[model samples]
Target: MTDSLTLRRPDDWHLHLRDGDMLRAVLPETARHFARAIIMPNLVPPVVTGADALAYQARILAALPDGMMFEPLMTLYLTEDTDPDDMRAAHASGLIKAVKLYPAGATTNSASGVRDFARVQPVLDAMAEIGLPLCLHGEVTDHDVDIFDREAVFIDKILDPLRRATPGLKVTMEHITTKDAVDYARAQDDSLGATITTHHLVINRNHILVGGIKPHYYCLPVAKREEHRLALVEAATSGEARFFLGTDSAPHSDDLKENACGCAGCFTATNTMSILAEVFEAAGALDKLEAFASLNGPAHYGLPVNQDTITLRRTPASYPEKIITGVGEVTVFDPGFPLNWSVLPSSV
Candidate 1:
């Protein structure tokens, strides 16, 4: 049996490195393995302007502990008032990689997101012109739609029309959770790609509401049924360039997460590589792990792959159940099964 594996260092196509203490606390967990990540900008005030993106990027670099090497590919949160000139400037200067579209009230700190898609048409057009990608949260927040049905409905009601309107605009649907999403992505061309999260691959809705409520497994665009999870596994392991790893390793303190109105996220940064290794191996697609985790994302974002390499060996993987931060203790994601492949220390 194969006992050791090595590949080009990976990149997180979608990541949340919240500002200040939380950023400092979680940055290392991801940097320890990933070479770069498309950093989310849904902070309290959001990073909407070119100036805002620059400032946020500086804070992220400053928060990085010495001796570690990682790049924060910043993103501007798309808003109704977003300036096309500012976005083009950011992309031209290499200050930001993409623009994130969070439908109003869809997820955490999305109060400032777009309520009217038409208002942002100019910005979207500019993005297509400059070849900057658009990252979508991929859910509609309408009160009438069932929580589980929001993704599919959003595709029909919003995404389809939006893509149709902007033919050449590149798009990446983040943290997709359903078979419907997979089929839609498959039907799209090269300009469209999708990210599959670590948690979504392992847990279904049952993991959240089965015997009891499991808040840690809960996240925005919440996990779907077993069929969907299986579909995600197949797409990810299929070695398709259109799908890649985006841990979406969102963190919330224990106090905030285990409460009456808990936050939406799963902190998987600490052990994502090991968990992915175990997952890829199980599907008998160990050969495709590098393509899914390392190669696909950079190709999608038009960035060069990292020259460095990481090696994984057959060994029991162990990680902390909770990570302590200046804000509060954040729980690490529990993948349910024991992870047998651990990244070798030298690979870091």
Candidate 2:
């Protein structure tokens, strides 16, 4: 058995590090392992302009703890009123890496998301022209559609037509949770890629309600059935450049998550590396872990791979179940199985 493995430090292609105290509490969890991350822009006001993105980036930097080295790859939250010229300036200045599309009412803090796809055509055209990528929440908010079917339905009703209409507009179907999504991504051209969350690969819908209501397992683009989880495992371990890691490590307070109307998110930043190692090793694809976690995301974004490296050793370990933040405790994602693979302390 391979006792230890080492590879380039990974970057989170999609992540949600909310602003203020929550941001400071959770940023270290990701920074401890990941060299950089594509920071989500769904803050209360949302980062909608180049100025908004720049200000948010400065806050993230200011929140970083002493001696920690990390980079925040900023993104703009696409709204119906999003100014294409502002987007162009952000991209030209290299402050923003992509534009996030959250269908109206699709996910947390997405009230400002686009409802009319036609209204955003000019922005989409500009993005395609400039070679900028669009990150999608990838679910429809139609009241008639079953929650489980939203993802597939959105692909057919929205994503397919949009891609066809805006040729060469790079799209990232973020936190994909279904076999249909996997198949769609496989069928699409190189301009289309998808991000698989660390939590989705480990849990299924049953994990949330099989025995009792497990709120922490809940997240936007919620986990699907075992069959879908298996497909995510297959695709993630297949070394397909179009599929990569994006932890989507959203953090919500314990009080909020435990309430009757809890928010959607899983705080997986704490143990994502360890859990990812376990998942890859189970599929006997340890050799391909680097490609999925580190190489592919940067390639898809037209960026360089991280130079630092992290090592994982085959040693059983347990992580805390909750993280204490100023607001309240945040529950950590439980992989259910004891992790035999653990990331060693950083060496680079």
User: After TM-score superposition, what is the CA distance of residue 91 in candidate 2 from its true location, in Å?
Assistant: 0.6
Q: Model 1, stretches more than 4 Å misplaced?
A: 345-348
How do the residues 1-348 of candidate 1 rate in per-residue lDDT, one tens digit apiece? Answer: 799998899889889999889999999999998889999999999999999999998998999899999999999999999988988998999899999999999999999999999999999999998899999999999999999999999999999999999989999999999999999999999999999999999999999999989999999989999999999999999999999999899999999899999999999999999998888889999999999999999899999988899899999987999988999999999999998988864553
Q: Model 2, 1-348: lDDT tens per residue?
A: 898999899899989989888888889989888999999999999999999999999999999999888999999999999999999999999999999999999999999999999999999999999999999999999999999999999999999999999999999999999999999999988999999999999999999998889999999898888999999999999999999999999999999999899999999998998999889989999999999999999999999998889999988867888887778889998888888888876666
Error of 1 at 79 (Å): 0.5
Report lDDT (CA) for all predictions. 0.93, 0.93
TM-score for all models, in order of appearance: 0.99, 0.99
